[model samples]
Target: MAKEYEFTQIIKDHEGVIFKITTIYTNNHEDQKDLYQEIVYQLWKSFDNFRGDSKISTWMYRVGLNTAITRLKKEKRKGNQIGIDQVIMKQTDQYDTEFEERLKILYAHIHGLNELEKGLMLLLLEGKKYEEIASITGLSPSNVGTRISRIKQKLKTQIVKK
Candidate 1:
């Protein structure tokens, strides 16, 4: 396949990763959509620079996360926001009210995390090993392990406080 075709195919295969990164950065649906578009745009611009040193998915996560964190900071600086009414919520399958509420609250806490922790936790939740997380984030594996432990403790404390 051509480079373009290969990139497009790989992106299609892992489309969920784009949204997963975006959602960690923004709860606002409009912000999420904007961030998603920007991540795709960044990915396209840098695709040629990707030399397959890591897995394509790894490359995607690195680019997607860097784009999201940059975009998030830009949005925060601009203080521009859409009205809640203008925000579009994606439909999800209905779960029992209690389960739904808990899921929502869990996501809320995840969203409250700082930029680095958000990426770390999201990667961990995706079942990335500490070494993989370290590779993506450029931290040492031991450092990644320590941070994940700390993050877990913090999240548990936060949950207890709620």
Candidate 2:
């Protein structure tokens, strides 16, 4: 019961992280739902081992990214190229046409990023600090900064080409 409660609390607090990671890795609604379930299961399985060494959200991000990467690689081995054409981010009621166009372009460039780059961008987009992103991604803080700079430039170039 205690573990169940803990898992429930984690889910309530960090479910958005799971969904966002799933969206970044998956191309369709069905795959997104499946990846979300897999992430939740992994979190539950490892919940007992969580030692409070990091924030729960941080731990969740690490686990979520690892699971998504593993799943993606496995699918790749099976010759699957999941194209992310489905728009997961809904336009708000007050959004202008300009915002919508920018959003589409953003998603396009995001889809062009590799798996590791996608993870980094997702973490950055979630407003994680450099240290936190480095910890989750097993990179040095300086490396995180450098990589983010490069990623931004790449994204700029991609959007410019469109």
Query: Which parts of model 1 have CA positions greater than 4 angstroms off?
Result: 72-89, 93-98
Superposed on all Cα atoms, model 2 deviates from the true structure by an RMSD in Å of 5.2
lDDT of 1 by residue, 64-152 (tens): 99888776344443445444223233435557778878878879889878889999999999999988999999999999999999999
**Per-model TM-score versus the true fold:** 0.84, 0.82
Each prediction's Cα RMSD? Answer: 4.3, 5.2
Q: How many clashing residue pairs, candidate 1?
A: 0
